[model samples]
Target: MKGYRISLIATAWLATIGVATAYEIDCPTRINIKSDHPELEATPEGWQVSINKNRSLLLTSLGVYSDEPVKLFELKPEIGIIDGKKHDLTWQINSAYDENGNYVKCSYNGEEVQLAKKIDPSMKSCWAIYANDENQHTTAKLICSTSKLQEVE
Candidate 1:
């Protein structure tokens, strides 16, 4: 009886340890655009930029919030030259309403900020991710607006 109890306790401890050591995958860097824009495209390296008339601008670097199902709504980190100085514009979606709702709350770096001027869910361009320039000269801009995101393998 004593030997059986010891074995059971050992098994339980091992199971607990295994559970504690389990790892979770971090979000990737990608953006999904639901609206129609002739000038914007996602790069092979997982960044979004504008390609207007053969001219391209490095808009932002995308970061994922979830990895399992790969959602489109995630982080936006932008690095570019503003006013002749390099800047990093990064932002994340802090909160948002359900499918029936129409509000999205976001945070830049650590401070709460406003999104773009327009947010219309019915237009399929409702949802957006925003980030501010590190210089503080600019507030926030819409990185990309999408209605939904597809799961990534």
Candidate 2:
């Protein structure tokens, strides 16, 4: 009876290892980031950039959040120079209806600050640090490539 039980446990362990390997895959090594024009809300979720007048590309982040954990989302916008062009992004989202059933939009009026220099074939990772802000808000969206996904030290 003891030998039979040990054999059963061994088979279960091997099956578990096989299933884990089957579901594992390597993420991308590099990603191209572009300005999500006409869309001001491009942070860690992904980026929407116009490649042409009628075409656009989208890149979104994937992960899970937990209680009071600190994380950094890195963003690398395409580098270039354009005269009289605006690079600022403004974020706005619709809020939950109030008791009177009125619709409203809350604005995240904070300015987007770049924490690292633009890399052209660049190797440096840009970081978007999220923590306690002046408004006592603890939530915000971030945009970054899969390669930039990492745990904060």
Candidate 3:
């Protein structure tokens, strides 16, 4: 009976917390983790996220070779998954363009991140850019594809 009770308690806790991979975000620019985790450092190469003493995590723009800075704003418990919890942080790192003018909004989500870009008025393309890294998955990598996105009107 005692063993069964223990099992039930464990199951209940798991349900409430859910799975770590189960957590999702649309644009995860920053990740918030609990204080219990190791120190998070933003190296020039990339971000060295110490999930714990046992493992490490790295968050970088999906790329092979580029010159975009592995942009990191703060170093602390501010964003991402912490103890099966979601901590999402967003910053307008560079909003001068947006302030200068307006463009169509982007819509996409990822496991731990999501970046939305507006449709460039002149280019007639919906380019999604994060920090200095533009969406290079399908585009021409560094340069924003001209007709990748349909013109919205």
Best by TM-score: 1
Clashes of each: 0, 4, 9
Sorted by lDDT, highest first, which candidate order results? 1, 3, 2
Give a tens-digit lDDT track for model 1, residues 43-82. Answer: 5686666543332122332232321112334434445432
Estimate, for each residue in 1-153, the C-alpha lDDT of model 3 and write its tens digit: 999999999999989663322111123333443345644464456655555433222234422111121332221212332332233321112233333322222122232332333323333112223443353322111122222222222
TM-score of 1: 0.22
lDDT of 1 at 21: 16
| Cα lDDT for residue 17, candidate 2 | 61
Of the pair 1 and 2, which is ahead by TM-score? 1
Score candidate 3 by TM-score against the native.
0.18
Candidate 1, poorest ten consecutive residues by summed lDDT: 20-29
Per-model TM-score, in order, reads 0.22, 0.17, 0.18
Judge candidate 1 at residue 27 and give its lDDT: 19
Best by lDDT: 1
